[model samples]
Target chain A: MSVKNEKKFNVVYGEAVGAVAAHSFGEPSTQMVLRTFHSAGIASSVVTGLPRILELVDARKKQQSPIMTIRLEKSYAKNYEKAKQVKAQFEEVLVKSLLESFTEDLKNVTMLLEFSKEKLAQSDLTLKFISGKLQAKFESIETEQEGNKLKIKYKSKKEMKSARTMFVNMRNFAIKGLQGIKKATVQQDDDGEFYIVTSGSNMAGALEVDGVDKEHLYSNDMFDVLKVYGIEAARNMIANELKKTMDEENVSVGFRHIGLLADAMTYGGSIKSAGRHGIAGNKASVFARASYEETVKHFVNASVFGERDPLKGVSENILIGKQINVGTGRIKLAIKKEDLKKVDAEK
Target chain B: MVVHEVLSESEAKKVSAEYNTPIDKFPKILQSDPQVIKIGAKPRQLIKIHREDPTGKYSAYRYVVESV
Candidate 1:
C-alpha cells in the first residue's frame, strides 16, 4: 500500500524593456580585451584598443620604440540599476560640456530654420499673390513649381504662409526643447518622474521653474512626451548637430527615438529609416559618416600582415636557414634510390 | 525552477500579493557581481528570480475541494 503526498503551486514572471543609455569603457580596443567576459556569458562589450606594440626600422640595425595606445567604450549591463550607475559616472567624466553644445545647437538650428523660411517665401511671390484670389471656401494651399524648374501639380491653388510659419515655429520649439537632453544620473521621484539633473543647467531658468510636474521630467505623461520627445524633426537635426560637441569632448550621445527623431529632424524634408530605401542605406559603409572605417581597416590589415611576416618567411626562412622540416620529414623514407637497390640485392 | 505559464508585472504583483512571499525567501543566491549566478543561472544572464516580493508574508494561499 502507498500514500500520496501533496504540495502547493503558484505562477509568476518578470518584466523587461529595451533601454537607451550611454555606456563607457576603461580603454580603447575594448572589444577584444572584453571578449573573454562574453565567453563567460557576461553581458559586456568593449570597442577599440591595442594589446601589442608597433615598431619601425629606419636603417643600420636600429629600431624605433613603440607608441602608447588608448581605448574608449560604452558598456551595457543587464541590470537597469547597475547600468544607470555606470552611465552616471561616464557623463561626469566626459559629457560635462554637452549643455553648452546644446545651447549653441539651438541657436544654429533656429538660424537655419529662419533662413529656409525666408528662401521659401522669396521664391514663391506669384503663388502668394494668387493665394489671396482663391475663395475662403476652398481654403486651398497654393502650390508653385519654380525651384530648379520643378513643376507644381496645383496650377490654380493658393499658398498659406501662416501654415508654413506654424510648422516652422513648432519645429523650432521642438528643436530648442530637445537640445538640452544629456545622459547622466537620472533621478526617479517616488511618483515615478524621471529627471536628469546634471552638473550644470543647459536650459537656464527652464530647470528652475516650479511646478508639481517639472519640465524635463519624463513622467510618461502624454503631454510631457509630446512637448519634449515628440517635437518635430528639426529639433533632432539641431540635436544631431549639437552632438558634435560630444565628439569634441571625447564623449558620445546615444541615438534617441530614431524614428520620430529622424522624422522631426527631417520634417518638411525627407523621411529616412532602414527599409528598401533609406538615407543610411545609400551609404555603403556599415556605420555613420563620422565613424572611422578606413583607419580601422588599415589597422586590421597591418596587424594581420605583421603576424604573418610574408617578407621574412620567404627571404629569411627559405634562403638563410638550412633545409626546413628536416628532422620531422625527409625527401625519401628510410633509404635513397641507389641505397634501396643495393639493400634489396643484399637481402 | 519556477515555471511561469504566463509572465507579467501585474500578474507577478498579484501572485506575490496573494501569497505574501518575500524576495529573500525564494531559493536564490544574491551576489554583487551579477555576472556570476548561483542556482542554475546561465552565463549571459546572472540569475533567475522567482518574482519574489519584499512583503512576501502579505500574500495568502487558498484552495477549494468537493467531498463525495
Candidate 2:
C-alpha cells in the first residue's frame, strides 16, 4: 500500500517536464520587472529580476558587481578593533585620492606629486611606500621625497604627452587591499558580530586573509564559486540565486522546477545556459533545434550534416502535428480479443 | 560507503526498461544531490535507494531512479 502511494507521487507517464518547468518559470517571470532597484542594507544588494535570471540561466562568468562576504574567525569577529583592522586591510586606498594637487612641469619633463600630513595619515600611507611601488611599476622612474611631498621625474627624454597619463595611472594606483577588490566595509549583525564585506570578488586571495573563516566566505560571482568549490556547489548556488531572485519579487515557484533547470544546465559536468549558445542550442534533434531559434540555420545545418530528427522530444512532435508524448499522449493501448480465444482453445 | 548505491550502466538500462519509458521521463535527482554525490552517480545514471519503512511492518523498501 505504501509502495503504491509513493509511486503515485512520481512524474506521470509522458509528462513533458521540460516544457512544464519552462512555463512554470516563464509565466511568473513575465510579471517580474526588468530590473529591481538595489535595496540598501547589510544584505547583498545585487539587482534581482528578469535581467538577473537571464544572466544566471546564461551562466555568465562575470557579474556586474561581484561582492564577497568574508566571515572572520570567532576571536576576530567578537572584537570591534580587530574587525576594523581586517576591514581596513581590505579597503583600497588609491594614490590619486592621497594627492592634494598634481602638477606637470613640461619644461623639466618632471611630474610633481605632493601630499598633506593628515591625508597621508588618513590613507595609512607614507612617501617611501608610494615611491617604491611607483619605481617598481615603471622603468627609469626617479622619486625624491622631501617630508610629506614626493617628486616624480622620468628619465626618458621624449614623450611629454605620455607624462600626464603616467601621472594619472600612478594616482589611481591601489596602495592597500587585494587587486580587483575596489572596496571593503565592516558590517555588524544583530548579534553584534562583525565581518568584512568586499565590493569585488577574489576568493583565493580572501582565503589567505589572516583572520578570514575560509568555510564561511561566499561571493555573488557564480564562476568564482565554481572555481573555488567544484561544480556541485556552483549548481546549488545557481538554483538558490534563482529562487531568491524570484522570492524577492514576491513570486512563488516550486524548488523542483528550478532544480530541474539547474540540473539540465549542469548535467554536462559544467554550467551551461538554456540559451542559444548553450544547452538548447546544442540539442541533438533537428526539429527541436529548429523550433528554438534560427529555424533556417538549424534546417540548413541539419541538411548539410544529413542530421535526423527522431521526434523523441515534445517540441519536434508538436511541430510535426503529432500528439506530444506526455500525459495521456505518452500512453498507447493494444488489445486483441482473438488472442484470448486462441489461448482458451489451446488450454 | 554511501547510504544509497548508484546503479551501474547495465542496471540503469534495466530500470529504464522496467519503467517502459525513456530515462528522461522518470523523476529526477540532481547530479549534485548529496546522496547522488556520495554514491558517485553521474548525470543520467540511476541510483538505487533503500529505506526502512516507518511502520516496521515492511522493514525494507527500495526505489531506483536516474540522476539528472
Candidate 3:
C-alpha cells in the first residue's frame, strides 16, 4: 500500500474508536424487538434481537438454543435422499423411539419391549442390532428375542425400585447417532443445495460424519467454534453473528463498528465480555475500573494494593473533570531542558 | 480464519525491536488454540496473522500465551 493510502486508512492516534463502536451498537440495539423466531416444526428456534446481542456481547458460555448448519459434499448436496443419510448420523435415535409398546412384569422381574416394525424400517435398524446393543449395555440382564418382541429379564431378583430404574434406563438408552444432538432436518438452501440443520451443535462429531462439508460446517455456539477452529475463527463468528442478528431485526449498522467490537472482545486470545467482568474490569486506571461497576470493591482493592491512577483514559480523566486524552486533547508540547536553560528565568 | 505463521527467534526479536514492545506484551493467542496446535507453535512464541477485510489485507501479531 502507498504511504498516502495507509495514512488515509489509519485510525488517528488517541481516537476514541471503542466509544464510537459502542455507541454504534447501543443506538440500533434499543430499536430491536425482543423476539425469538421459530421456523415451522423442523428447525430450532433461534434467539434474536436484543437478547441475542446481549448474549453474544456478554460471552455467555451456554446459549439458550444452539444450532448447527451442516453443509454436504458436492455429490451429496444435490440429492435429498443422500442428504438424509448424512443427517441421520446427527439425529439421536433412542431405544424407546423404536418401541411400539413397553410392558414390565413386576412379579417375574422381566421387561417386555415390543419393537415397532415401521419405526425400525424407517430408521434402517434391524431387530438383532437392537438386541445386541441391549445385551452390550446391560451385561447382567438376559435378553430373549422372539420375532419383533424382545424380553429382558434380570439375572438376580431385584426390588420394585431397582426394576423401575432398570426399566427407565432401558427405555432411554441410545441406539445410534451422536449424543447432544436432538434432531436433524434436511433443508434446501437458496442455491437448491441440500444441507442438514440440527437443533443442537456438536462440531467435532459433525465433522466426522461421512458426507459433511467440513469446511462449511457452522455452529451458532461460540465456545464450540472456539474449541474446533480457534480464536481468529471465533472473532469472525462474533462479528458475523452480531451482523446476522441485527439484519434479522431489519436494523442496519456499519460492519466496521461490529468488526471493531469483535476484535476488542477476542484480541486477548479469549472471548471477554464488554461488561464489568471483562474489558471494563481490566482497565489500567483505577478510577476507570471503579467507575464502571462494583464501585466499592474496586476502590477497596486499589487502596489495599496502593494502586495509582494514570489518569490517561477517558473515563478516569472525565471522573476528575479534566480534558479527556482524545482527539485534540491528546496533543502535548514539550521543550528540552537545554532550550529552557538558554532562556533567562525572568526577562 | 486467517492464516497464521510462527515467527523464528531472529524474526521475533526483529519484530520486538521494530514495534518497541516486549514479546510478551503483545496481544496473546493461547498455546492450545487450534491454529497454534496446527502450526505446532509453543508458548511465548510470536505468530504473524494475515487477515482480509473489505478495505484490503493486513497483518497482525500475537504472542502465544499458555492459557487465557
Per-model DockQ? 0.01, 0.07, 0.60
Task: Please tell me which predicted candidate would have the highest lDDT against the true structure.
Answer: 3
| Candidate 3 to native Cα RMSD, angstroms | 6.0
Alpha-carbon shift of residue A275 in model 3 (angstroms): 1.3
Best by TM-score: 3
* Span of 10 residues, lowest total lDDT, candidate 3 chain A: A33-42
Rate residue B16 of model 1 by lDDT. 54
Ranking by lDDT: 3, 2, 1
Q: Point out the higher-scoring one by DockQ: 1 or 2.
A: 2
Model 1 CAPRI rating: incorrect
Q: What local distance difference test score does each model get?
A: 0.28, 0.74, 0.86
Give the alpha carbon lDDT tens digit for every residue of A36-105 in model 1. Answer: 3445553422211121101000011111211111111122223345445433332211111111221112
iRMSD of prediction 3: 3.2
TM-score between candidate 2 chain A and the true chain A: 0.72
Q: Which stretches of candidate 3 lie over 4 Å from their true place?
A: A1-7, A33-44, A94-175, A304-308, A336-347
lDDT of 3 by residue, A1-347 (tens): 54446548667767899888889888877766433333224353677677788899999998888899988999999998999878877888889989899899988889999999999999899988888988898888888899999999988888988888988988888789875688889999899999999998889888899999888989988999999999988888999999999998788887778988888899789999989989888899899988889999999998999998878789989999999889999888899997787776544
Q: Estimate each model's TM-score.
A: 0.16, 0.65, 0.77
Best by DockQ: 3
TM-score of chain B of 1: 0.29
